[model samples]
Target: MKQISFKNKFGYMMGDVANGLTFGMSAGFLLAFYTDALGITAAAAGTLFLIARLWDAINDPMMGVLTDKMFRKRALKHKNQKVDKFKIYLLKGSWPVIVAAILMFFAPDGLNGTQKLIWAYATYIVWGMTYTFVNIPYGSLAAVMTQDPVERSSLAVARGIGGLIGNILPRLIVPLVLVQFTDELSKGYLIAMILFGVIGLVSYIISYYTVEENIVHQVSDVESTDKDGFVKSIGVLVKNRPFVAVSIASIAMLLGMMVNSAMAVYYFKDNLNALQLMSITGLTGLLPMLILAPIMSKVVKKFGVKRTVATSSLISSIIYGALFLLPSNAILYISVSFMAAIFMTIPHMLVWGMVSDCIDYNQYLCGKRQEGVIYGCYSFVRKMGQAFAGFFAGVGLSLIGYVPNAIQTSQVLWGIKFLTIGLPAFGMFIAFIAYQFIWNLTPEKQKEVVKSINM
Candidate 1:
């Protein structure tokens, strides 16, 4: 097997960069495009998000099991049994995902409201499916890349960095560019996604070439021989305290993050009266991530993922709570936002490593290698978080009486502030509680798990 190198690290980074370009864009800006650009009602847009993500959540596991089945079959067929299995799907699925991204943003002219809603549903479902097709495999690729806890931690950091870069680029560019096309909002998003798609696909291609699964371990056909494999594997994972805790906290984190992202533009535009601040926040918020991402492994090693994440979650909640209390003080808000963003970085860089550790725990308890299954289940929870965030944002906007392309009412602005700032704090608090009470996967414990897996 090949040794992991800078090339592999970069290739893996590119994979998330690719994902951030498309997935991140949708997460951050797509709701605005639906509510503001297309004049779709906030309630409808939220419902669409809920249904689509729920469907995608189901697909996440099915795809996970299906991929593992493919691997077992291929492994049995080959004498060499050394082929890189997981990274192979990066190129295969990215093109369709990229294409679906563009289409989801683009609806043909002269479509009535129901037709537009139908178009949104069809396009989004396909987009979500295509995303699942690529993401399950891509996410699973990291575990096989190396068995070293430090190296896996590094990979997670790389992914966080890449996702930040990918997400940030579009986050900065799309707002600054799209706001100018107020009259052509739909066209603006379509064109932005078109540009993002090419970049995302190219990034995936780079990743496919460079990222290698150096740890040549396999899940034997033992799983296949059992009639109740998927169920039994899932039950083990559910019972895994660390995995379950991580999943719960991850759900809260994703929910709050999505709400913050989806609502940032409105907060900036309506509350701050500075749409450009969106781009500015993206740049400033990225500082800690970029600076701290390289050293995240050391940080995780020093504090342990649970402590860092749990502590960061508490600190972040305070920051967000403070932001909510500050009203419309732009300077104080921005400064505090930067601090929260910095704390938020700790979890992004460490969570995957935690998930990796949980996978190890699964291997320890279940005595089977079911990385894809666990990761997929983890992803399913995160997606549900995203779904709820989407629904929450949409419904919150409606309740606030948010109107399209016009000055927002005072109540609407207050609601935006509440959704943007208050909810995130609550989410972080949940993370802190999860870490403190539920998850017990310490760094030392992880080392022991790895050692046991190897032996």
Candidate 2:
């Protein structure tokens, strides 16, 4: 097995930290920002999310194809020089995303309702596209960095830890900081988002400088020029059973994680009577992931990724479902949620390495590598879940007659409870079904594919 240094591993972790800071910001808080700060309707905000994500679904595959073509051109031009296909995007794309991330939250301070909506549309869509520009390459980077399964699992753990830090740190600090700036909430969001954006930019640069792409898979000249190459390649991926199953699982997994996140403000504010409590709850909930992330590779070695994810999903489903029955006491809410988060974290920590395995399975089947395409396709499916979650959070709120700053009725409170807790239970249960039945890339099968590719 090839060895990767701690520095290289840390740099790899930073890439996902970059991803989580921007994405977690939007996923966890953007909908609330829209309705509360800008006076956008819950239905309108949900529609905005759905429409933007549908556009992203179109963008991911296109970016995948473009990335592969660009890498080949650069490699051919610098035949004698070292040319890293993925890092080039990371190096150049960081600033555009930083700018986009800040602008996405800015919303221009004062605009009529329609104009604010338009600004939201333009900025968020641009941010999503720019995010894809970096995210696809970052996701693809791991497959090239190491061909060893053990090393890839370690990389996945590093990424999960970084993402949790990026995600959790904001939750801990943002609510507390926002408390101090409550008189002007919009200004608070803009200031908070700007800080996260700059942090994201620095992490991206660290990742760009630190990672070495040790394995380069070259595209043959004929394959590059084939008129139908992209389409044909996608067809191959569709036929790759493990890839298809995993992609389906991605959709379900994101759906659960996101719905829970998107509805968190409602749960904290309406159900529990203090939005500030989110910071403490988030810190407690994340403790298990903090404990589990460092030793996750060993956990994977003992139990295997597929089995681990499936079991975690099952346990998390039960715990979150039970949360739907707990009394509204904050102590009980925090404690049960803390236990549930332990299981909620395992699948996330291991899912990316499982994705890298799908890449190996692709090469084994076709004798061709398309890491960018595969990762992008997987991301595209995952975005469907995101799209639906955004739509669901909005529509679900509307259906329950949620008023942004008013005391919710018991009926509305129940809806908030279901949206935050019960929906995730449903989402987790579906994920359990997907991985337990749909995913077939057992460790034994993965070993066969890796051996076949090496041979």
Best by lDDT: 1
What is the lDDT, from 0 to 100, of the residue 219 in candidate 2? 49
Q: Where is model 1 poorest over a 10-residue stretch in terms of lDDT?
A: 218-227
lDDT of 1 by residue, 105-212 (tens): 996889899988998899989999999999889998888887777788888888888889888887789887887887788888988899989999899999999988
Model 1's alpha-carbon lDDT is: 0.84
- Expressed as tens digits, the lDDT of each residue in 1-455 for candidate 2 is 44789998999999888888888888888898899887789999999999999999789978887887787777778776667878778778888888888888785756999999998889889999999999989888888888787899988888888888788767777787678877777788888888988898999999999998988555463244334477788888887876776777667767877888888878888899878888986688568777997788888888887788888989998998899888776677888888888988888887888888888887887777777788888888888889999999988899999998888999999898888888777777887887888788777887888889988
Give the residue spans of candidate 2 off by over 4 A.
Answer: 219-228
TM-score for candidate 1: 0.97
Shift in Å, residue 230, candidate 1: 1.1
Give the whole-model CA lDDT for all candidates, comma-separated.
0.84, 0.83
